[model samples]
Target: MLKVECKKWNQSLEILREEALQAEHPRTRERLMALYEICGGTNATLVGKKTGRNPQTIRSGYIDTMNRV
Candidate 1:
């Protein structure tokens, strides 16, 4: 049920997708891809399934990073 707080995003979905693709680090790409998916209306659970990650990682870890920015 976790959702992305899109208002806080400084970058657009296209930018996020591009950066995710270009990201060299595996962890960084995963986080960016999670954000990109969430911003595009895919929920955390679904994104987690797609990425083979725990939903909480997307909901709390990735999304929470945005809060600190």
Candidate 2:
């Protein structure tokens, strides 16, 4: 079970949503959407399915990058 500490990123779900929509790059939008959904209490499995990625990739890929940021 992974938790998205949105506060640590200085962003809210709304902020992530806006950024996702404003993002010019497809991959950037995808990543922001993932964070937005996860922060809004979506399951990684469902998000992954929506994004056509593996659940574990959803967990490890952006989550790991989010951690670094």
Candidate 3:
């Protein structure tokens, strides 16, 4: 995951966050939140702890989301 500048990136997740909230599966939501947190200046390790996912999973998921979007 890239290092996020919080002030610059936090509010930019409106669309992604909405997609995350509307996701039906628990894993998908977790993946989306990992992306959200990463883009919000939260480190992947912390995001993993918060979301109960592995840090690598957070990073990979964020990258995957980025590729898709």
Candidate 4:
């Protein structure tokens, strides 16, 4: 069970990373990271405008992506 879960988690992380790379805007991923940093590494909407996403979207996306790891 643990092995299965780990495989799933790894796959998810790969998908998320690919999505980030294919993002329409280059700064979208960067903004996500910035927000992560601004929120004390917890993730927050510090640069919403730059990211082209609202606080909620950014938070959810970041959480989803991080969870894959």
Candidate 5:
């Protein structure tokens, strides 16, 4: 079970890396990087405050936007 979870996590990381690579808009890329930095393993609230967005909103929107691409 842990191995499966690890695999999925790795795959998600790969997707994020690809998205970052393909990002063209400076703002979008910045937002994505911020989201990545916060969501990578740290506290979400800290990121939200730093970005001037609600944590839940930023998390949901970031995931939604990334999944769309």
Candidate 6:
């Protein structure tokens, strides 16, 4: 399982999921969904395959979302 690495924030996966649902920008929402899957222990490569995001892009989105929270 991949652990969330942020020391300043410990947001629950559910909160990320909900935020993804509420995000105003389509791109932001899409990235947030990828971020949610990553936090749930889904492999970045698998999320990339399923969502059509590059693996590196998925990881980057995960990192960006973690910092935002």
Q: Pick the candidate with the highest TM-score.
A: 2
For residues 1-69, write the lDDT of model 6, one tens digit per residue.
344553456667887789899999998898778777877888888988998878777766566556666
Which residue ranges in model 6 land beyond 4 Å of their true spot? 1-3, 64-69
lDDT, candidate 6, at 8: 57
Which digits, one per residue and each the tens of the lDDT, describe model 4 over residues 1-69? 001122444444445455556678866766434433443433355445555668665555555554455
Looking at model 2, residue 25 earns an lDDT score of 100
lDDT tens digits, residues 1-69, model 3? 465333443346775688789999987887766777677678888988887777776666565546545
Off by over 4 Å in 3: 1-11
What does the lDDT read for residue 6 in candidate 1?
57
Clash counts for the predictions, in order: 0, 0, 0, 0, 0, 0
- Model 3 collision count: 0
Give the candidates in order of TM-score, highest first. Answer: 2, 1, 6, 3, 5, 4
Best by lDDT: 2
Writing each residue's lDDT as its tens digit, candidate 2 over 1-69 gives 676778997888899999999999999999999989998889888999999999998899887779777
Q: Which candidate do you rate higher for lDDT, 4 or 6?
A: 6
The TM-scores, one per candidate, come to 0.84, 0.91, 0.69, 0.35, 0.49, 0.74
Measured by TM-score, how close is model 6 to the native structure?
A: 0.74
lDDT of every predicted structure (CA atoms): 0.84, 0.89, 0.68, 0.48, 0.57, 0.74
Q: Candidate 5's residue-wise lDDT over 19-62, tens digit each?
A: 65679997676566655665466565676788787877666666
RMSD of 5: 5.7
What lDDT score goes with residue 19 in model 5? 67
Compared with the true structure, model 1 gives a TM-score of 0.84
